[model samples]
Target: MIDSHAHIYLEHFEEDVEEVVERAIANGVEKILLPNIDSTSIEQMLRLEEQYPDVCYPMMGLHPCSVKEDFEKELQIVEDWFNKRSFLAVGEMGTDLYWDKTFWEQQKEAFHFQCELALKHDLPIVIHCRETIDETILLVEQYEGKGLKGVFHCFTGTVDQARQITNLGFFLGLGGVSTFKNGGMDKVIPHLERSKIMLETDSPYLTPAPHRGKRNEPSYISLVADKVAEFLNLSRKELDDLTTANTNKLFFPSK
Candidate 1:
């Protein structure tokens, strides 16, 4: 199975990062994608990728919430990295209005700049939309016909919104939030075609039901697959096959 989105670079796993990754592999997770938060996290994420080259693939981008007054400088650093190395994608980038709106303009600028990078590099992206679905959709539409593609990670939108995103050739990334009793993803997941979906853990956050409120890790991605299987009325193996195939198409395009 593939964890299409995760933050194993965070300090939460600094003490047992190796064990955490081992647990994920033991749990059946094959590949894990690490999306960068900002320039600050680049080295740590790159180190994790190097340490576990087979399992951890690094993505470069400035997270919406991380956009600040120095966002331009941060983006310059990201651009420089992209020029020097090949990354999985330009991602974990989008608009986040859930937090302070002070940096809304900066977020938009950063997102557009990253989108341009994706176009130039001919790579996909991992969008991080939070309470700004409308704005994000608008930006995505602007990239239409420019070969822009990627997943909307931690998706929490209406069926109509999901359709809109998929229509634009993007995938919906489902994680542990779907397992929440009150998450409402139960309703949303059923409406989405399995082909347009990809599984993710977003760890160190959104841990599944039995482990909710605790620190999330890639090992719990199975819980998400199980929930998705139940939601779609399919077997676990079926869900895994379908989502894994979709993930491979999006993240490992060459393969």
Candidate 2:
């Protein structure tokens, strides 16, 4: 299976990222896509990619939470990287109003900027919409026919919102949240379009049930897959095949 979204490059795993990758591979997670937060993360993210070129795919973007005063400079750095190298996608960028709304306007600006970057680079986007899925959807709708595609990473929206996103030709990335007893995804997942869904772990965060309070890792994606399989009423293998194909089609189309 492919862990379509993860941040194993973060310091949480610095002591044993190698072992984390091993555990993920052993647990059948073949690929772990890493999304950049800002300029500060580029080096460690790329280093992980270089060390595990085949397994750790990196993406470029300035996260919404990082959309502070110097956002333009951060975006310029991200753009320069795109000009310098290849990335699987342009994201984990989107509106996140969970913590504070002081940078809401800046976050919107950055989100649209990166959405254009996705289309400009002909790449899928990985979104992180926290407490603002609808607003994010409205922003994304403007690019519906411009060949902009992506996944709503760590999706926890309602069924109606899921319909809105998938109808816009985007995919919903499910992770540890689905395994949460209070996550409320069980009602939403069953109603989602099968092909418009994919699996992710968002590692080092959103750790799943049976390990909710602990740090998440790519290896735990199988548990995510298992719970999601239950949600969609498919066997583990079926969910694996479906999500793997979906993830490849989106981020690794050449494969």
Candidate 3:
């Protein structure tokens, strides 16, 4: 199985991060893809990636919530990192109106800039759309002919929204929210195509049910897979193969 988006590298897991990886591997999570939050998170993310070169992978970008008045400077740092090394994608980037909307314009501008980077690097993007799904979709729509592709990470949107994203060649990432009785992903997952979906824990955050109130870790990916499989009516192994293939295609495109 693949954790398409996770931030276990953060301070939340600093105490027993090694054990966290061990538990995840023991539970069949073969890879954990780490997304950068901002300039401060890069080192921690890269450090974890180095420790588990094969198990943990790193992606570079400025998170939407982190966008501020001087977003241009933050973007410059993101672009500089891209020049310094390779990243699976140019994300954890997108618009978020759920929090402060003070830098709404800057968030959109930064998203566009990262989209341009994805087009230039021929890489995918891992998006974080909280309350701005349509707005984010519209921004991505502008790159329609530019070969932009990636996943709408932690997707808990409507079926229509899912169709819109998939139609554009992007993927939907399902997480713990789906397991919530009222999460409503039940309406979206079953109607979707298998190839255009992936599973994620969004760990240290959206911990799956039965463990909902506790700290989330990669080891619980199976709980998410179980819920997703129940929606698709597939076995655990079947779902794993499907999402893992999708993850590999995006992060390890050369394969």
State each model's CA lDDT, in order: 0.93, 0.92, 0.92
If scored against the real structure, what TM-score would every candidate get?
0.99, 0.99, 0.98
Query: For residues 170-198, what per-residue lDDT tens digits would candidate 2 score against the true structure?
Result: 99999998999988998889999999999
Q: Residue 242 in candidate 1 has what lDDT?
A: 96
Error of 2 at 97 (Å): 0.7
Model 1 worst lDDT window (10 residues): 186-195
Error of 3 at 245 (Å): 0.8
After best superposition, candidate 3 residue 151: deviation in angstroms? 0.5
Root-mean-square deviation (CA) per prediction: 0.7, 0.7, 0.7
- Model 3 ranges off by over 4 Å: none
lDDT tens digits by residue: candidate 3, 84-122: 889889888998999898999889889989998988899
**Candidate 1, overall lDDT?**
0.93
For model 1 the TM-score comes to 0.99
Steric clash pairs (candidate 2):
none
Error of 1 at 187 (Å): 1.0
Q: What are the per-residue Cα lDDT tens digits for candidate 1 across 83-115?
A: 899999997899999988999988988989999
